[model samples]
Target: MRLALLSPLPPDPSRLAHHAAQFRRALNLGGIDVLTPLVGQRPLESLEAARAWVAERDWRGVDVVHAELAPGQRTVYWVLQALARLPHGPALTATVHAPPGLLGQPLHAPFAGVYHARWLPRLTRQASAWLAAPFTRHIDRRLARRLAGVLCTSDASATRLARRLGLPRERITVLPQGLPELACPPLPSGPLKLLCLSGPGQALRPLQDLVAALGQLVAQGGDDLPPWQLTLAGATAASCFEPPRHDPLTRLQADPRLKALGDRIAWQLDPDPQDLPALMAAHHLLVLPERPQPWGLGEAEPGPTAPQGACDLALAVGRPLLVAQQSGQAEQVTSGNGATYTVGDHATLLAVLQDLLTDPDRLSDWATQARRQATSRQWTQMSARYVGFFQQAVARSTRAATK
Candidate 1:
């Protein structure tokens, strides 16, 4: 079947880009015909141009149009607008990454509002008009009514969206993001190194708290504590709470204990994907301290779902993961052979770090289990699940058309 994979192409760090790349790779491996639009610089603008581009192309043979949703409030609206204009729109399927309620709030809320409160004055004003527009809810409801099928990266994301859109659970499929398989080297014997990978935004507050807790641990434990290093990767210096660019190592440098361990704490800025597997294998543990935002004022804080590419990459490399209890991916980490700590609980984080440092054998055992769990959830498998959903969506649309 010819499938037109609709999504923004590279140079951007969007989840859609990652998914598109993975899906294309998997579909090719499965010997499927996939056609992607020619993406240029400035992808969002390019998406608008795609409608006209697809119209002129030969889409008669295309069986389906699988559009990956962008991470924004007006994603559904944009998709709907594109679909309405397509001359030969095939049966449509969409993947929604963020939860539905997220569309109602300010787009900058999770991106800039939380961490970079200093930038809020300007950023909020810039994004306010877009956030105030009420058209998103209308578009969301319309997409729910029209879409042939929906996909989410996590079960919790799917369930929440299913309820919000008032769609049946069976109509929404949960397909976790796939991680590239990697060969893990033997566990390092020296100081334990922990890696934190996250976007540069308010979402990194949990990571800051964890680092502060680690400093406290170093001061309190002194000689009794095992030698360890915390490597902060994929985040910028601006996001650090401390002024003058608070990269992880810089923040911890104030503590006498941490200051003594020179070259141990490192900050890697935008390392290549090829370097990640080796980095993950070198680290004794991976920590993601992502705290969830309040879901609708009435609901209690929810538990974490599963980790995406970063955590999964660590898992594939046989590294034990440490995530916040409130992270959406916390349950996945704990269940899939990793450890968890209560949100903002530095003592618990420190204790876990210390334990892993002291007992190398235990760390190795967790790593083995983590690798085993990660291998079973490969991108090839995820693509197959997506293809099945696409087939079902086509069948359903055909039935509806006949009726």
Candidate 2:
């Protein structure tokens, strides 16, 4: 099969891009072509730029065009719709990497026509957001229906996307993200190190409660549990400590209780994507404090529907996960591999941490289980599954055209 993947390539630093490159390599039997929009040396910054770039491409004789659609990539949605409408277009499909619900953000921005537009007035954006709030889901549903088929990384995401998109669950295929073959490092001696990774643009407000719980743990001292250290690191060279006092890094840096932990709680405010493997290896556990109401949003707000790159990387590196309940990442944490805590309950989290840290044997077993699980999710296997999905998409599209 000749497959055209609409996603950025590696060296781009997007987890989606890195995965795409992996998938392409693993699908060696299939002629897979990667297409991306770049502005001179760097990635395109706007939806308009992407659309213009795509318009100039000659997608002739491709068997299928599969795009990776994330929260803000409305351009991909537009492309999917455009290609599907063509008289002799390739089969249209997309890997919806986020909850379709979050894709509505573009419609609420001040300059709604462009993705990541920064020059708009603050008041204008706020007003637009307020006005656009009610119909965001409706827009999201329409955007989702544009594709012939959808792919998701987990069953949790598939279920959520099916509901939000008003499509039958059968229409969505669940394929876990591929894991890189990473060699497990020897478990570090002394203090059990924990790592929390934040995306380049992710704010620290969502982690404030987690920070508070860690502060309480620090204040209690390590009398019952083994010594532990946390390194809150960012995915790229951008500060995650912005927008609120509810920020974890800000509280850690400012509060005396948290500061008492000193270097025990470190912050890697700027780290490149290439640094992730070393960070994962150095830490005993990977922490994901995603809540039901993520980013401090209200209960009615739409949260993420899939685990980020950190979760996959941790599993690949054979590190146990400590994720909160109801998060997509939590789905990866089986009792054999890791543990989960109630979403907003800090006390439960504290207890889970103490239990894990107190028993080194259990942590070791969990790490081993994690590595075993990751081995089964390698891209070489995942690529075969993707090929099946792509063929199915083409067959379905062909049937629809006949009708």
Candidate 3:
């Protein structure tokens, strides 16, 4: 099949870009065209730019036109608009990385101005976001229905997106992130190394809760508790505008903790992608903090769901996971693979950590289970599923057009 994928490609430094690149490589179909949203170094900041880019492409002979989408992304919006305007074009489908809504950070290239500003401009951009937020969701939902299929990373995400888009659940496909090809190295011994992945403009509350839990562990240090360290790792996209004060790690360090645990936490912000496998293998457990509510000033206001990259990474490296109750990662924790704690309940997080650390045998067994699970979700397996899904989408689009 002739497939055309529109997404931010590698050297873009975003998780979305990485995933898209991996998927493209794994699919490895003949005659596949990889179109990027970036001009020079960053994503196209305006709808006009995205439209012109789409118009320049000769989409004819493409059996499928798939896009990788996220909130506040104007490129996806304009590309979908162009596709809808096609009287009879390639089957339109998209992998919606996040649900339809605004996020704590200006996820769109144009919204960066709001996040980088300290005062009036920030407020004005924020107000503009508030006004445009609903319309964004409206467009997302509308375009979603026009496509042959929608893809999500998790079942919870699929359910949420289905409801938000007012589309039937059957129309959406839950395709978990594929695991990278890597052997499960022996679990590292020494201070218990824990890893958590965060994104730019991520909510602060989850990290704060984790720090509070770690502080408690430090204050109540005893022979029963294991020596441990937590590493927070994330990549910032080129399109994201981050000032020193707005950086997640900087803000996290500034927050006052109950106990001053020096050197117990490490920051791995924007590590090279090639170094990720080694980094993951060096850690004993992966932690995914919970953000029950989406990122926004108003807790009541809904926002896009978080990505499931950490969970996928944990499986890729065969590390056991410890996630909060509300985390989407929790769904991946089954039987002996991992454990979960109540959302925002740092005490429970601490207790779970202590339980897992004290029992080395259980942790090892969980690591084995994680690797076992990863084997089943490897790209070799997922790529076949993706091909089947695309074929079905094309067939469905054909049937609909005939009607």
Top candidate (TM-score): 2
What tens digits encode model 1's per-residue C-alpha lDDT throughout 195-260? 876543325456557767777777787879767777876634554343322244334336555455
Candidate 1 clash pair list: 115-202, 304-327, 304-328, 304-329, 305-328, 305-329, 306-329
The lDDT leader among the candidates is 3
TM-score of 2: 0.77
Give candidate 1's whole-model lDDT: 0.63
Worst-scoring 10-residue span by lDDT in model 3: 298-307
Model 1 clash tally? 7
- Over 4 Å off, model 2: 10-15, 29-60, 71-75, 101-117, 126-146, 198-208, 211-224, 235-247, 291-307, 326-328
Which has the higher lDDT value, candidate number 1 or candidate number 2?
2
TM-score of 3: 0.76
Q: Write the per-residue lDDT of candidate 3 for residues 1-403, one digit (tens) a residue.
A: 8777777676766656677788887677422454443435345656566667767877787888887765444566566667767788789988876575312234344545554455655467667566556665676667777889888777888888887788899889988778877888879979779887765556677778888888777767655676788887775443244432134555675666822666777878777757777888989988878554343332122211133555777788788888886676667887478888876686788777777768788888888898888887888768788888888899999999999
lDDT of 2 by residue, 1-403 (tens): 7777766677765555566778778766444444443212334455465556556777776778888766555555556655654676677788775564535455434536432344555466445655665677676676566566888877787888888889889889988788887887767777888887654334455466677788777667556657788987763322433232233444445766556667778887657667778888998998887543232211111211113667888888888998877445777886478988765687898887777767789888988888888878777766677778887888987887789
Score each candidate by Cα lDDT.
0.63, 0.67, 0.70
Question: Model 3 Cα displacement at 66 (Å)?
Answer: 0.7
Q: Which segments of model 3 are wrong by more than 4 Å?
A: 10-14, 29-60, 71-73, 101-120, 196-205, 214-221, 225-241, 244-276, 290-308
Q: What is the Å distance of residue 302 in model 2 from its true position?
A: 16
